[model samples]
Target: MITTNIPKLRQFYKIKAILFLSLIISTSSCAQLLQIVEQTPLSDLKLSQLDISNGLKGALDKGVEKQVTKLTAIDGFLQNELVKIVLPEELQIIDTKLRQIGLSSLADEGIKVLNRAAEDAVKEATPIFTDAIKNLTFSDAKNILMGNNTAATTYLESSTSTALYSKFNPVIQNSFEKVGATKVWSNIISKYNKIPFVKKVNPNLTDYTTRKTMDGVFKMIAVEELSIRTTLNSRSTPILKKVFALQDNR
Candidate 1:
């Protein structure tokens, strides 16, 4: 090996180290500059309201499929309080009076039958709700997503109330017949009338039960909508998660 100057060699190493450090600093500075140029302000990035509305509509559709369909099944409304059908206004007084006179079991049966009729009738609700969802406009979705706890429900009622009533009425009539609601009420009223000192009670249970059942169905849907809106864990489905994530961002 040829003899080399130790001092020169040391100087050369020092220069190399300086050049390496300079290159690293320059690269780091360039990276920061690029980042500053490319970064976007969060406030400047606006989400599409239409997209948010679509997400809400999708969430509502999922809720109907998951929760509302269960109510149409046999004993569904009778068992589920959140969607349980109660006696209509005209029948409610009669039902209460009957229970007060120790006809509690009979009153209970009457209540059950009313719910049963609702359960039978709610088979019509799925198709009606489905149709309503199909007809939902962008504005409807936007308002619903940005609305209160019952916003989605209000939207549904506004758009589909008339059509749903038309569809539900005939089905409720048939359901009354099928579940013996009419017969039960007739018997209950007849028995109450026969009781000494009891006033006559002739309630139009069909109409009452129909309206109550419809209200119950809407109540259940609203419950589901509120749950998904407020509870992070309730967004269980993938679609629900993705859709609600959008809502959360808003």
Candidate 2:
């Protein structure tokens, strides 16, 4: 009589299950490998160090020309809500108190003058930014290109903030004087100080305005840098397209 061996039958089924699992795992792994291979094409593998460096420089130059130029123009900071200089924390209470007391016009003028000072001071930034961009090395280019969208702007800010602050502070101080912001703010603060039973404020306007002006400059550049990194059409030049393309793969 023919009889089935229970142990042999169990071992054969277990082996079949193991083989099926192995097949599934191998297929999934191959699919993942194929995806990785497709993401990084062979064409970009030959991109040279100099090409990447120049491409990053070109992108920054375009960003500076487009965005920083706007900051230097009349009403650039005042009109642009993105980078407009608002009152510091110490001054906001003064603004609110004045507006509540029917001194809204004065509050408005106080804010307007701060933005005007920023617009004037940002005019000095383009040269500093250009010098920084020109000095970018290959290592910086590789790291920045592979980094997040605003990486280039962050690099520029870190490398140039100290010099920029030194350059912008005096200019911002002078701009406050030139644009009559000093007088306007003085009047606002004097009136606010005179209000009954309110805490007095005598914040340093020069330091505040200088820092805000630099912040606006970097913010605008970041906007452009992000656009170039994310938006396909914003890469206006050939070098930008080629270098940033490598970043796209990552």
Candidate 3:
């Protein structure tokens, strides 16, 4: 400027010089990084799409095998506090009232039968889950690979809930008959209904047990998935190691 102050002009030039140097340094750094990446071998990077898909399926299958199998065993639900099927809210009142009336043994059997039905129904779960895992797409693998610890379990639930329910409901219904739950609960409910001034109650035990069993299946699956995601020893396979390494980087 024709009448620019000397101090102001010097300050402006100094600021401009600093910005020019910063731009040059940033550009150089980016270029250096790009060159390094380009020279790096693919083996040092993430795995192929097919490898990732197999790895994800493997983890899901492992979860189904380990956790679901446990649920299928005798006393699986009855013994395991984590996935045990307890009485619903309305039934809890019945249990308390029955126990107060010196029918504690009968009440206990009622509860045990519910868990038995769930355990029986869980016997049908492994195949359904294995089929769902086999259908895992590459896109699904990519998303599940980058998702949180339970994301694969969440995906399995969403994909298999309908099929599992259809498969489990009838099995639980039959199991109730097979395991004498229907008789035990019938006696318990009859006794509860006869209690003085109590509200008469009729609940759908089959639907209730089916839902609880499904919840247990998914919960167990999530436990294994979390273990695999967090514990290196739990990976258990080379592909699992490589696929999850991508997640570790992310």
Report the number of the highest-lDDT candidate. Answer: 3
- lDDT of candidate 1 over 120-215, digit per residue (tens): 777777877877888788667756765787888888777777877787788878877887877887889897888777667777766666677778
lDDT per model vs. reference: 0.75, 0.87, 0.90
lDDT of 2 by residue, 1-250 (tens): 9999999999999999999989977778977876555435424566677888999999999989999999988889988999888888767899899999999999989888888888888888888988999899987887899888789999999989999999989988898889888899889989998999998887778888888888888899999999999899998888888888888877
The candidate, 2 or 3, that scores higher on lDDT is 3
Report clash pairs, candidate 3. none
Q: What is the lDDT of residue 112 in candidate 3?
A: 94
**Candidate 2 off by > 4 Å:** 1-44
Name the weakest run of 10 consecutive residues (lDDT summed) in model 3: 34-43
Candidate achieving higher TM-score, 2 or 3: 3
TM-scores of all candidate predictions against the true structure:
0.73, 0.81, 0.83
Query: Sort by lDDT, best first: what order?
Result: 3, 2, 1
lDDT value, candidate 1, whole model = 0.75
The whole-model C-alpha lDDT of candidate 2 against the native structure comes to 0.87
Pairs of residues at least 3 apart in sequence or in different chains that clash in candidate 1: none
